[model samples]
Target: MTVPVSPRHDETFVLNLGPQHPATHGVLRVKLTMDGEYIVKAEPVLGYIHRMHEKLAEASTFAQFMPNTARMDYLHALAFNHGWALVVEKAAGIEVPERAEYIRVITVELNRIASHLLWWAAFLLDLGGFTPLLYAFDDREKIIDLLERITGSRLTYCYMRFGGVYNDIDDEFIKGTRDFIKRLRGRMPRLYHDLVTHNIILIKRIKDIGIISAEQCRRYGATGPVARGSGIDYDVRKHEPYSVYPEFDFDVPVFNEGDSMARYMVRMHEMEQSMRIIEQALDKLPEGPVMAKVPKVLKPGAGYYYSAVETARGSLGHRLVCNGDKNPYKLKLRSPTFSNLSLYGEVAEGMLLADALALMGSLDLVIPEIDR
Candidate 1:
């Protein structure tokens, strides 16, 4: 598509990045007003994907919405699954067994690592380093196979239930997880840092670029690594403990620099923290029933309840209004990417078009979540 020069403002023109572009990752369109490759303003255009999730929840039973959770953010689907379960469980006052909580934490942390690994791969590819992309995927595939063994889906998982997970992890899953943890712990430095992070070009490309201040994060309600990268010490798993997360000891990686490199470093360190959580949970794995004894058809009492989980991208909130019915009265999802992407317009204004794309990549957006 040709972007004709504006005769009145000869140096400026409006350009559409994509409703279908590889850099946009999903069906995300951005209308940008640019002056000679420098973006004058950036406006994200959403709604390419229909949400209907809240309406669907109102029509379907509590248990039936399990699959819908995964479709929103397929990269971190299990976290969505956990958030949905937490929503119904909190509203219904369901008691999950200690063993099941541990299982959920373990699975969710593995998924988090997998999500970060994929981001690392894709982000590197965006930066024009294709070799690290292969290495990143090689590491991510191990965790993916491990998750598929128990969750039964490699991408969009429907493994979580109202009270606990739908299935119990066997010895094979345990062994696979342990082996994966060890392998990733060993290869992370050489494959990720030495190959990509420390490269001079990579450093020039990301470091001190697209700076986001802590004030900007607060203004935009950005969470996860984006906030953490800007020196905001808020993580849902820590700030509002849930599941078996409080039991685990891990550090929240923060970088005060607030640049694209800072965000990249935060995720890189987070993968280590996730593996640490996974190892600790494995060592303390309890032996009991994974599935809780809940009604076949779950009908939460009349009330309003919300649940928040720390996904790969950040805080994922699921709010529900129940009216003593099998289906919810209303459901609202607070997606982190939506809030994080909101700041893109302000941040991208003065940056070069390439750096703007880099900043977008650093946000690790799952567009369907924003569209929803």
Candidate 2:
């Protein structure tokens, strides 16, 4: 919802945020019934970039839909790739090798860092700070370049197959990841101190603004930092124990205050946590082929299968129904941003316009994910 000027009789009027590509992240338009600067009611209008991916899934071969997964959440595209691969593997009873699993974990964690970094940059830009974007990108470039070396493309990657990954990791990838970890680790303090923690303007703007409680998150089915920030420890990685995440030791960050600042801190802490996972993966890097042996033609004898993974945004779930065909008869994608964005109407009701914007930014939404 947007903030408009004062009206006569304290009359409530609808304010359109966007169906255009301004600061609302994507073409998200929030129709706000405003009673002179305060939102009386909030309703989000969606479907600006709806691609009907589920219908496309019915037409394409199971493997052909790999690229489509990334389109929904480009920031965490690898997680989408991994999620799709996971469901198909489960459906067909394909076993990923131990080495492939390690490679997948490492690459996914790096992608997670890149996603969080971009969100950090964009969220700061929404707060009117431009410099953070540069620093964030400087570090993020290393991850993109590293992934591109193996995945062949940078942003919307389709590097995962049903049983394993597209390519194996060489020493180049291993060393590059190690160097990047060192580089980014040294820069984390500045990110926290200079731009966030001690900045009075940011603190005053976000500290107690747009509070979302634990009850609110549970009610809304909010996950990821949006849920964790509100003291709900429901990370798919930890709670569900997907991939090699159970082997890694990292604490989920939670804040009881549940304000925009709490969300901000959660992501900042998560970046560090992601680094921990990547470091452990690199050290335990094994030797083997990345891709597993599978039938040239895939025909799963499946009724229904579901798989979930922790994307940078939250829990990304893929459900498929196969009638012993090469293509899925039914497909469902559960995007985290959609659920997180749904909470906006309730949380943003009485917040100041600027504060509401900050809270929305804190959610770190990628609109294509919501629209799809």
Candidate 3:
């Protein structure tokens, strides 16, 4: 005799995971449709910290707009400032002095290192490792000190002008950067690489998890380490070549693994490459005008211009639709974190909670940038 089986229903739960949780990073909420620990579907709900930066830019003058860029990515404010300034300079066809260009390159690269160090620290913290955060902060403080001396600000810096930098670098500033670079170089192997990269727990946690292929990355417009980890050679600095980057020699690190660990390795190697760029730039540092001559009150002709620069996270683009007026007609920013976050829904499907957090961390989503 055989027993007849009855059609049965399995209960499911709708989980509101974050928006207040420590793992969410900011005021980020994830609505998850789940069956036990595995996520059947995931939706990232944004707008928690919306500031309407694009619309606000339209009401401000070209020169007045530089400060707003810093508010988007508080971690890499200079990159945003540089991105907007470069676009405006290109649009207006203003020539930046050679010295100004080198200073821009050096400062941006140093900010990149600072940004990556913070990421490294936060990433390790996400994995339940705390020591790397302290070590990373120790290195980052030196960069902050050097930048503050020249820029007169630290976190949300407004140092880049439309045609050049606000101030020139002094001997003390140069010496600070050079010494900090040497210190970071010496500590890289012992503190960063050995401490986290060699940690068996970290390796096991990230490796072979949250795999994203090259095709998916391109489809989603993913840039930076997330895209390069998928074997795509798409660094804006190399491919587009802006702001004296053409004069510098550096390699864009690529990894074919397309996993979280690959993303980690790519960023780690990128830190080293940033150091190389800085050293080269310092060696060839020259004496010249640091600011380009431009009228006190500026206005560009009516037209839309788009420009991009590689930030610590990835490619940052600015779209300005100018009306030839003092104020912009319209403005938009293509933040890398926005595009990188777009891939989250597809990548997080069917993943466990731990794996999803790893994937989210791998994308390096900056909430302000996303909401801007």
Candidate 4:
């Protein structure tokens, strides 16, 4: 049995939070030590929903592993899918066609916007506000619709090919995306910022609560907005530019506040940056073969390969060891949520139950991604 940390010099109460709580956003069990309603310490106990995705990936061929990507981060399946595809492409020196690269950027950016929107909704809902949930879904639904036309699925899409995308985008898809970006950009200020960012209650709830400093972030291996919130000045998209990210013009938002509000601001700014990337991708759209010329039977040389991509949650890495055989010998996923969740125990200390919940929300953990 693990001993609970006492918030005070003496006298401490142990609080059992959920494997069923709404604030957790998934089936997460947190052991919290409390001094009244304020959390003295927080510990996350995982594996309730673990599917052994790494084990499953090792049993599948290079071509077959793409579907498993979606199962990890269902909210941002395309980003996960792209990460897997890019790694395989890089390992075998397979070149993706120009048009395919452009399509990949567009779809991934759209999915990113959707993931951030969902986080905004859930984060607000966790803080006792309900309207943002519906508003976020309204915008997210547009992206889902635009992607479903080609991907043939919404939640868990298997749309990416090894060296390219599975299908070519049409005029209707491009036009729909243009309209969606415009509508979302116009509404975000009114619906998200004015209604939530400036709300006195939200400000009081998150401003200085559940803080994590720059040093603590380094200790915890934090990445993405969580690291950026502490002024880390690191974004995998920029540090390790992949896909068409090198061609895009956007800024990685950073903040030095190192609190829940800073994390929230980072995500909001990222959404704007994602919109900018989408508009540029749409305008610079090219035409060519969407599918690359790949072999019917892939036998990559036995070697270890590591690839990382910036998901909406953070940096997602896939490490694989192939044996020049039909299937992967070993596979490992370095999920952003895994690193982000590690900071929860340290940061949630001395925070109220509501503040802890908000802090977890700001981390933007998709439990499936972590547990996988």
Candidate with the greatest lDDT versus the true structure = 1
Q: Which residue pairs clash within candidate 1?
A: none
Cα lDDT tens digits for candidate 4, 1-372: 113345574767787788888888888999988887777778999988999988787777888888888988999999999999988887778999988999998899899999999999888888889988999999999999999998999989999998799999998998999899889889978888898899898999899877889998888889999999999999888999999889989999999998889999999999889989988988888878998899966777789999999999889998878888877788889999899899888877766787788788889989999999
Tens digit per residue, CA lDDT, model 3, 1-372: 012223222655678867887677787888987766677778889989899988888877888889989999988899999999999888888999988989999999999899988888887788788998999999999999999999999999999998899999998988888899899989999888787899899988899878899999999999999999999989999999899989888999999999999999999999899989988999898899888888877788899899999998899998888778888788889999888888888888778778888888887878899999
RMSD of 1: 3.1
Spell out the clash pairs found in candidate 4.
Answer: none
Total clashing residue pairs per candidate? 0, 0, 0, 0
Q: Order the candidates by lDDT, highest first — what do you get?
A: 1, 4, 3, 2
Tell me the TM-score of each prediction against the true structure.
0.97, 0.96, 0.96, 0.96
Which scores higher on lDDT, 1 or 4? 1
* Worst lDDT 10-window in candidate 1: 1-10
The local distance difference test score of model 4 is 0.88
Candidate 1 lDDT (Cα, 0 to 1):
0.89
> lDDT by residue for model 2 over 23-50, one digit each (tens)?
6988999998877678767798999999
Collision count of model 1 = 0
Off by more than 4 A, model 3: 1-10
Better of 2 and 4 by lDDT: 4
